[model samples]
Target chain A: MARWLLISVIYIELIIVSLGTSSVAQGGQELDWAALDWKALDWEALDGWELEGEAFAQARYFPDNPLYIGQHSQNQSLALELSAYRKFSDSFSLEFIPFYRHDFQDDERSHLDIRKAYALWASPTLEIGAGINKVFWGVTEAVHLVDIINQTDAIEAPDQEEKLGQAMVSLSLPLPSGLFDLYLMPNFRERNFPGEDGRLRGALVVDTNNPLYEHKDKDHHIDWAARLKQSLKDGELALSYFEGTARDPNLIMPLGTPSPVLLPYYSQIKQLGLEGQYIKDEWLWKLEAIYRKGQPNLQFEVEDYYAMTGGFEYNIYSIFESSQDLGIILEGIYDQRRDNALTFNEEDIVLGTRWSLNNMHSTEVLGLWIQDADSSAHNFVLELSTEIGNSIAVTVEALIFSEQQRNSDSGRFTADSIGHQMRQDDYLQIEIGYFF
Target chain B: MRNNLSNPPFHFLASILLMIPLLVQAETAEQKGRAIFEEIDRRDLNFGDFSSDQEMILRNKSGQESRRIMENTVLEGGNKDINDGDKTLIIFREPKRIRGTALITHAHQQRDDDQWLYLPALGRVKRISGASKAGSFVGSEFSYEDLAPQEVDDYTYEYIGDEIFAEQDCFKVKRVPVDKDSGYTQQFVWVDKSEYRIQKVEFYDRKATLIKILTITSYQQYLDQYWRPGYLSMINQQDGKSTDMIATNYVFRQGLTEADFSENSLRRAR
Candidate 1:
């Protein structure tokens, strides 16, 4: 009941903030672009286009045996990303970025994406942009609930940190109170799942060839979003709303299908999110909460729910009088949907620590432990990375899974929980990259 | 005797005679140090705003060297009524991997600064704790505390005897940071007498051991008033590592407003 009240208060605040008049349009001396003199602006003196790129190779080794046939114990992949940027004038610029990856096994794992391709027109008071872009929005170290702008590129990694490019037309207004942004998306992108031969997948693979959607327009449905973000002297806050196709798909098996394959079903959803953070000396407090409607439950019935993740990070600078900084992080997660929720973090605790060596090599280490509140299920992840020379960097990561609900027969494993589904997929990965 | 002491002329004369030594002592080393620093601060008071291109070359003990290039913009802020401090934006341009990365800082006079870092790869702007200001900046010998705008109240000063440095007569001043979080226990600063320009600085660690020495050179006057350094060299005396920072292409009074230094602009700092 208190959660409902808190959401209600936030809704009221959102209404008030949105209703406030925009100061950008209030200026009477707006320039008429059509009447502006173009010849007076020199075109020959502008700087030429610049290019940057990164190429990397990665290997993952699963300690536990594969749960299904065709799944390999070892996986290797290579990826490349290139970005081209150009500035036509002081207020106008263009950027294009393309990425490609190839996997030695699992053909579906190899993919290509246009991370960013956009033209931006910016001024002191306003900004307008349109193209394929990526927008990240959240303030949590664990699960990111408020970040809904892009589809998750799940095939790239299980950490959910990789995102697909989004096609959008955006407008930004910087006012005295805060920065307001509006986004219009005319198309939808589906989340790619791991292939049948992938290691970190459930017993039954998702039939990506055929998918279902609640909206009649399918991938052509129009979506919209808006956000109001402000940075205070010692804190920051953001209020956001998105109405579109849900990023996460619900898997269901139809009765009449010839094969018993799980088909992904995308449903429409409306999400209201709030993010805030405050810094007090060496401690940083963060919170991300959302109230989502029209999401499917386990029984395929649409339901409304609220979820939140709050955390704090305390920093110890120059530990032992050395050039190292250690940050202790603790966070709590709560979701009203409980068992029916798709994510495993319904009620969990996240504890993590980050250490930065602050040396010439820029070495860093991160360790995270997530525990299930009601059961003996947990996940541990550790990562260490450092730079070599001026252009090369290497990273090593390990993911460990522990669960008591693992069935003896992996094939007959039910859709009980994500932690139980992939209990045998613990793996260690290493990556090396060259940037130019 | 009491009557004589109470007499107006006698009392005034006695007080004047007694005040001679006290008056001479009034110009103590501490006050003189503060006055000299105040003069130094007053001379470079207002440039409004400036933007500059910088190159930092890092050299290790093995004599290996690496370079990083960046652009910086600083908005002068000392408005007590508005409670505003100096705002700075630094955007990295070189070392291809970290290109487009930016950092925005809001410095405060009496409290910890507020800092935000923008990672272009993730399209994320993260607020980092300012408690780590004592740490090295981007693996350079310069600490964050050294880059931050130095406010007069941030340190207590004591003027030492004059000395000659770099072929110039300089006043040596010992300054201890008022903030306990400072990496250095104390620092000795040398300022030339002619323009009150910083000539050299020696940093002493917590154990009163000299750790680093910085030298500023290539002074160029802008707007016929402000003296800006064209080059800075900081050497870690104990570690045998050093960093050379060369700043050029300074453009002052660019008419930059507070909006340019907003968090929203960090992603678009290029």
Candidate 2:
């Protein structure tokens, strides 16, 4: 009799709970962070087209350009990225992304290009793809030193996050404990650099159209890359090798240019990169190292060198009872060919932080400070991104440069050095993107 | 009934005699609760593998809501090793930007669970460290720990008592997580003895306060022997947030093998 009575009471309570839930479900509150209905939207607007605008201002100027060339930069730009995608079945798909940008300050920065045009076929354990595509490798937060698959899209961004897609046929096969990918790239694309009129350009501007190549086949030479990656329970590792014309061009002075103009020259190169990361509790240890042959030295010789970037990241969650996370990232980079390497971050330390507010807006902020070991230069960058609504995104970035240590840089960028060239180009950028 | 009892209960005497073995087998509340849990696990061990499409709806205070659709495939434990837990893959399909994100988890009883996240943007597999089980799943109320395959040895149980809940006879049990880094200190669960299926659970946070309450309903039996809940909803008592997970479809025995759950398959899971 007691059991039956309790059952009746429990049933009553459950009905009350159900009623309460139903009322709330039908109440006045609105949806937050809801997945915007992608299926209901027009396919052409949702997947085919995107529009973006950017505003930029230089905070400081290098002494040489404004006085001699009278170049002062305050610029606005518009960009459009068009993508076409189709899926025939679970086994086949196609994608194409073409972007066009127009900059008011530099006409060279305004152009149309295709980033990717790829077709893919996949089985359960194997996949094959062909056409122009972008592939990224490495696992470091501060600097992606080992991600060398694609040439940089110089005018697109200063952070080196954007790339010009490569044309290749690739295959990925599953290993018992890892994944192996093989790529046969038949087209080589030279890197593009900012023009003289651009604020972020080097002191002597780069000639984008004209370039020399060590290989007689030049841009036609086929390049190849292979990677084997394994994912463990709490760690990951990858070994990748690339043989092709160097993506980073060596600057050579042309006969016509009196000012030390940089003519891009590609050289033969072979690189082997190893990347791995392991996580322990709240701390993550990341490492990326590469050994390369055929990087042009100071004497324009194919010299061999090694470089590495290692770091750790630690984060604190639910800060101050709010669903936010603050993460601290630290990494140190060292290069065996201190001044002969392609990048300016030789023997440097990077300190950065990431802030993520777990909110409906999906807001995030990242700031990084990279300082040279000799205390000659400092590079500081800050980026903040958030969604404006369901279909738009807004981002703001600031790049600041400190005093350059004259003649301290050991890299191939010795003439202008990355520090001095960027010192006067310190600028703030604001960009907004509409997805549909 | 009175006449029957007047005979000193021939049926009652036999019932008491029948209870002797049970009394011997379960001396304490903890043992009895553990035995029931282990029995349920054993009965559930027969299922080999299954897949389903699911939608997870999250709501904050003031009734604001957000929804995400995903597909999940789970391989039953003991199909390979008796001590091994289930292998599961969750593929996010909706919220367009995060589409094609796949998380594969291989749960083990002896050590930490292995997890891999295949990022569509990066086109690479990322290891979500074992220690990250305490973190939330895609910013939802459910943590990786909450969704992990339940192994009998992962928690210790204490029988709270028998009670009628949801119009059915139920066993109330308190379960304390044995994993040192568990976000919850203890959880109180309601299980219906008739089907040996979970009906409700109340989660206590690290501070041992009631943090979340989960209620399951719309149970449908598959293959005549497997009872699968159609919907599971969790409400955060402290934050007024909630998550409702509803399974839309299910397919059993697709001939999934251990290789299918491997990290290499994650990138191809779509």
Candidate 3:
């Protein structure tokens, strides 16, 4: 079975390469280099220290939200992450990161997580690592269609930026045409969601513990993922394949007490992804596409489909006579399932802008709007962040959901879907983070 | 390593004689400015490649300050048909949250420079769009347009006469930005005639009003060829804010290739 998986991975990679060859025409300027986002912590207070890494603790709060509260709820959380590594030998070492969380709103949302615990042996041209880690792959900003390695931690944030750790044995080797990465993921992890009384909770309660997998091995299934990334003269191209259980679960309405419970069905899948982007002066064009041979939707039929997203970002510097920049981004998302697509972004448009103040405080703002083409459904998000003193930073975020398809004939088709189900989840979030 | 343009006419009697036509005939003020700018640009272009450590210290009106440390690597790009500009990569090392973040700049002599930002936390590379050149360089007083390799063609120069400033004979040159989208309308530069080094610069706003001033305090010669400044302070004339930069640890010719500045190698830049 491993041999078969490897063979099919190679075959699919070849097809993707062939299809991408014609489109890989040229390259452009690689500016956006040296760009600084002050939102990232700067340890100036501990400057000139010989340490090779950094650590930070942050706290988050929700000033306003339309949700029922539980006893002792404070609608706040304190989280911290420390990323430090030690080299025992010259070329071998260990990396461990322990993250802590405490949520005043929900106890289930607070827990200690081992984000990365790995031992690595690296050389000039080859590298090998084993343990739990997170891998990210995708190009576009608004949505990530090709990043499928880690399961989403929904309770952490709705932006899908939080990922659960995955255990794996990974290897990277230099190929003649590009760099190749091979992975043997030994454990399957299900996505996490907020509890009933927690903020950002879904309409139906999610049963994360009793996930039903297509394979009887359940979490013991040995999954596989491979990627070939080539750096072109003007741009970059990557082709990847993953044969594993799906990270996203299909919701099943199991008959219980009829309080609307969601049973997660984890299906086995074979996925192929292609991503490419070019950097031009004052503009960047990006594209991502994925084909999957498994059930990604609520229904278990057809067993095959594809989804794609493409967009470009243009910049306008020194706006309104200030030495700041405003970057405009636009992307169109499409899925083969079209209107029936489970993903809320299918047949939708993403319009966003990024503002950089270029001050010492690294003041920045990002605004995004996701609009459904078939209906008047839309999701809007805004994030504004700045630094306070040397070690502390503040960020404010607001989310709005307007589901025109709610409770009507047009809303019935969108009922229980991502956008409609999230109609009342709009919230205002404020976070003040301190770094050490 | 000085280019021919940097060699003043006073160095040779024959070259001074060649310039007699300009003084005696139709020598526009702009021509004189171009001549002086060419000399400054030539003296500035030395060394093949180098790396250094940089600190940006920002202070508000209240005198409270914040600092950032980064490793900067630069590769000269004139000989390979890329014109006489250079490529620069800056990696933030001190910031705990932004550790391993890298930014690349591909500067050109004729067109607008390009920029790419790599966020290590997200493991992603993104291109910065819009008039990026006019944007600030990481919240510092120095704008991206100010840090670019000031190629001769990117500006129109004029000789503003010579005077003794900073106790040295200096040529005051007025440079008008050729790029239409430049944040600065014009800049007044004072270069020491003997060393061809820029001593002070005054920036005019987009409306051609004086806005900021940059002063270079000290310089150190590396590889016995490149003259790099050790301290620079930029003051905003309108606001009370300022930024001071301390550049240190200059290592030249550690064998950096053009490939070293590419996005592929940027992941491990630190």
Best by lDDT: 1
A1-436 per-residue lDDT for model 3 (tens digits): 3223433543454456444432332222543323322232133212222333223333444444444443222367778777656554545655556677777667767767666666667665677877777777878888888898777776777888887777888897765436788999988877777766576655676776677889899988989999888866346689999998988777777875556678788889999999997766667889999999877564545458899998998888777777687889999998887645666777889999999887767888999998887778888999999976556678888888876354335444432266665666677778777666
Best by DockQ: 1
Candidate 3's residue-wise lDDT over B1-270, tens digit each?
Answer: 356656776468667888899769766888978988787667656577888899889887889787878888888878663454688998886444465789888786665566668876565666554246777777778887776667788888888999887898999999988887787889999888877878899999978889899988788877666788899899989878888999999999776765566555554454
Write one digit per residue (lDDT tens) for candidate 1, span A348-423.
Answer: 8999999988677778999999987767788999999988877888999999988835532443332246668788
Against the true structure, what is each candidate's TM-score? 0.89, 0.82, 0.80
Model with the higher lDDT, candidate 1 or 2: 1
lDDT for each residue of candidate 2 in A306-330, tens digit (9 for 90 to 100): 8899989887765565457678989
Runs in model 1 deviating more than 4 A are: A1-47, A407-416, B1-9, B21-26, B79-83
Q: What is candidate 1's CAPRI-style docking category based on DockQ?
A: acceptable
Where does candidate 2 chain B have its weakest 10-residue lDDT segment?
A: B120-129
Model 2, chain B: what is the TM-score?
0.89
Which stretches of candidate 3 lie above 4 Å from their native place?
Answer: A1-74, A86-94, A118-131, A169-182, A228-237, A255-260, A278-280, A404-416, B1-46, B61-64, B79-85, B93-97, B110-112
True contacts kept of 1: 0.55
Could you tell me how far off, in angstroms, the CA of residue A435 lies in candidate 2 after the best superposition?
3.5
CAPRI rating of model 2: incorrect
